[model samples]
Target chain A: MEGSDKFFVVVIVMSIIFTGLGTYLFLIDRKLSRIEKKLKEFRGSKNNDK
Target chain B: MIKSMWWKFLGLALVLYSIIAGLLIDVPALPVIHQTIRNLFYHVSMWFAMFVMLGTSLVYSIRYLSGFRMRDDLMASGAVYTGIFFGLMGLMTGMIWAKFTWGDFWTNDPQLNGAAVSMMAYLAYAVLRGSIDEVAMRARISAVYNIFAFMLLVIFLGVLPRLADSSLHPGKGGNTSTMEGLDMTMRMVFYPAALGWILIACWLLQLHTRRRALIQGIH
Candidate 1:
């Protein structure tokens, strides 16, 4: 590959990596939010019992 | 502590700047490496980030040893997992850069071998964790093992490479320091790129530990 073409390839690889990382972070954030909500509900029910 | 968003945004902004400036900024022209030097920001930064993540793990492991808190153990493992993720990125990006510059996908260079060894050591930690069933025992044993593994990491990746007689990778016995070729212009983008990735790694570690905490209810 020409020099410019190789640079482009590197750029594409970086972009793909960035996308994968962003997607993973977003999914994990969503999962944690769900878990926090559930924990809050559980605590609220326990408080009601008291 | 992870609730703050400012640092996360700062990490994102710095990374964006590095990506842009790294690509567009004029780099020193040298034989063999040429423009591939631009990879300094992306490829090398991954290793930097990995180092910080593992360092964080080391701190948490020591904390676990002192207090024997299961939560500290969990956070330690979380940092390890995150460090491994960044290490994988570093490995892949290094492979790509190697193919283009060194004309090989993999080489027998000391630094490369050291990195591979360090990664396997951490992976073994994961496997070690899987073997135990009891909670406290798992935490205690893994915390001790984590410290050992980190020491191995430092020896392999940092010490052995410098002790080697010769290596294609920089910072070896004969080679100049890793930052030697990075002229002032390149340093502008490089430092922030590294710091940005380190912050991003911390953010990922926070998310990882938060998920682990919620599932295990240790926190």
Candidate 2:
């Protein structure tokens, strides 16, 4: 407590409100993976038709 | 982003921890950079992440040369783009830090100039790809160029900077032990921050590769 700075608290508090941004990035990454998988399967099935 | 969930979560957790701990942790009071020492968690972490992603690009480019697979080329380009993004961030952050400590936004330091040269070389890779009309030719040529760019990257960033007699930046001018200044508390946060940013760079590269793969597959 003796050596602590108050600016840290303000920035921390501000950062708290933006906590979900990383979760959003994570979700988009997962969603993109799903899309990529589906596209791969579609291509595979089409290749089988020939 | 690489069809892996655990590493992404770990990246997020570690970065979040570093953000909090980086702020709260006590740093050694040295001249010129007092509280700004906390910037080590961010500015240095970014350059590390940039190196990791660009190194991945170099590896994938070599893989493409061996196999000539379109997918490997896509991955190489994706890693390059992500690496460039991180490198740009590193430059911006360095500029900000330099303004405070070195009393100028851009100095004549060899380290800083070398970083600029490397960034320009990578940027040319993107421009080279865009100008090519054919897919296979673009991939092959750009893959080759990517390797050359990475070699230049290693030279400009690693070799030229150290050959200088002195530098405003740490770890330059034969002063290789930049991490030696970190104490235990700083080390705890800095290591996690570096690793987290590297993983996050991987996540971004995977995202770019997947999107590119999907787009190429549709055509």
Candidate 3:
């Protein structure tokens, strides 16, 4: 392959990898935030009884 | 958060727009760039959406710091996460366009570097939030860091790209392109794509925030 073509392939690969990583992080952020909210609500109710 | 009717309306509009942009508009073909122009619909739209989200989130962060309210913190978090989504969309679409137009995937160019830096800063925001366990303390610290991050994002995305000496993309460093060769149909498609994607971003953020509230209320 020509140098430019090889470079293009590399760039595409990097883009795919980074895009995947970003998507994964986006999912994790939502999941963790939900968990945090649940814990907060639980603590809030517990404190209300006391 | 928006109601279900909001999404239904937005979805219908998107579908109609797709038909108009694709079939009704006689978009000029850039043979050199091939299908790269298609990426414009996604890439440019996402950048604008990201900017809006980050700006909104920064506002909430400041409010949280001033008042120490939990709702502000939640809003700030919502904006940040949505901003990250738009950022990813922009990067992915840009990469595809770069591959065809530049005959390579990566250019080590100014715009690319700026975008990469902004993404890293946002990632750091998440990490910074994670490091602090106490709600009040976390919100305050993250707000301070977010202010710095917003400054960096503005500089990287808006200022540096224009002021720098080198770049691959067009409209870099004070140079603007006129619609010298663009046809009417291209304009129609381009305008709607930009507007439609922005609406979609806003709509998604509302849905996400509502879902969070619902889950919070139920448990």
Q: CAPRI band of model 3?
A: incorrect
State each model's CA lDDT, in order: 0.84, 0.83, 0.70
Per-residue alpha-carbon lDDT of candidate 2 for residues B9-76, written as tens digits (9 for 90 to 100): 88888888888888777789989998999999999999899889888888988998999888888888
Every candidate's DockQ is 0.26, 0.45, 0.04
Candidate 3, TM-score of its B chain: 0.84
Docking class of 2: acceptable
The residue pairs in collision within model 1 are: none
Candidate 2 ranges with C-alpha deviation above 4 Å: A1-8, A14-18, A40-50, B1-3
- The per-residue C-alpha lDDT of model 2 at residue B124 equals 92
Per-residue lDDT of model 1, residues B36-59, tens digit only: 988889999999998898888899
Q: What is the Cα-based TM-score of model 1? A: 0.85
Model 1, stretches more than 4 Å misplaced?
A1-38, B1-3, B174-176
Candidate 3, residues A1-50, lDDT tens digits: the string is 12443544554554466456445644654665676677788889999999
Between candidates 2 and 3, the one scoring higher on DockQ is 2
After TM-score superposition, what is the CA distance of residue B13 in candidate 1 from its true location, in Å?
A: 0.9
| Colliding pairs, model 3 | B162-B173
- Predicted candidate 3 versus true structure: per-residue lDDT over B79-133, tens digit per residue: 8899999998888888877887887777888878877888899889999999999
Q: Candidate 2 vs candidate 3: which has greater lDDT?
A: 2
TM-score for chain A in each prediction: 0.77, 0.68, 0.75
CAPRI quality level assigned to candidate 1 from its DockQ score = acceptable
Report how far off residue B143 is in candidate 2 (Å).
1.5
